[model samples]
Target: MKISILCVGRIKEKYWNDAIDEYSKRLSRYCKLEICQVADEKTPDKAPEALENQIKAKEGARLMAKMDPAALKVALAIDGKKLDSPGLAAGIEKAGLSGISHIQFIIGGSLGLSEEVLRASDKRLSFSDMTFPHQMMRVILLEQIYRAYKITSGEPYHK
Candidate 1:
């Protein structure tokens, strides 16, 4: 049940850090969790197609660098398949019980994931069609993951 979140950019804001820490603490009881924050390429004020691709590719390289070849990889993307909590819980349970031991969730930079990164994922997941700040999305992702675990354990938190 080991979980890893590899994302571009640091969580500089104190409030985002606090929320992430709280979930990390709660999840410690269930599995080992590692959060890898990588440096993000600076975005242009008015990015052109080529410039945006370059930024995403740079961030993609950083994300790919942190990846483990054997881990079950899940990429977060706007166009990815959307799953309910129960569905995600089922997927998580299946992965855990199938001897996968480790799961890596990739949250791309604010500009979005590069084609290469998306292509490498075993699963692509989306919370919504609407966009969110990468920092806040991390917290939300953690909360949903925690909820998924609770559902898996037949715990009351998911009730």
Candidate 2:
């Protein structure tokens, strides 16, 4: 199955990019993994909350267009259900067996995902309740993907 991670904003730091690359390479043995980026919304200081919401909605629209409509979408949010490595592995295995040809993981910007994007998702996932920057979250998501692959393969990485 193809696994895609759709996120707002780009990874500008070298360290963050390297970390994401490492786990991405490891995940290739299990499935195709792709990271698709959407432009982060521009906001001026002292902007109104409504403007932030509008930006999020626009970014969500761009992200949704990049995915296959038939693919299972998982939105990563603070309120989403948290899953450990093994649990995530089980979920991924089930998704593959359940006939989902592709799975897309959506990550929003600092303001978070729009309601429309969340509504479009098949599942909601939370890595943690604590908020993380979008760039750092990229590494975390990639590592989890690799860990899930390892668990499914009955490999030592999980230990």
- Among these predictions, the greatest lDDT belongs to 1
Q: Give one digit per residue, the lDDT tens place, for model 1 in 45-142.
A: 98898999999999999999899999999999988899999999899999988999999999999899999999999999999999999999999999
Model 2, range 1-159, lDDT digits (tens) per residue? 899999999878999988988888888888998899999888777779999889889998988788678999999999999998899999999999989879999999888999999998989999998999988988888888888888888888846
Candidate 2's displacement at residue 66, Å, is: 1.2
Assess the local accuracy of residue 48 in candidate 1 as a C-alpha lDDT between 0 and 100: 97
Query: What are the clashing pairs of model 1?
Result: none
Candidate 2: clashing pairs of residues: none
lDDT of each: 0.93, 0.89
Model 2 regions more than 4 Å off: none
**How far off is residue 92 in model 2, in Å?**
0.2
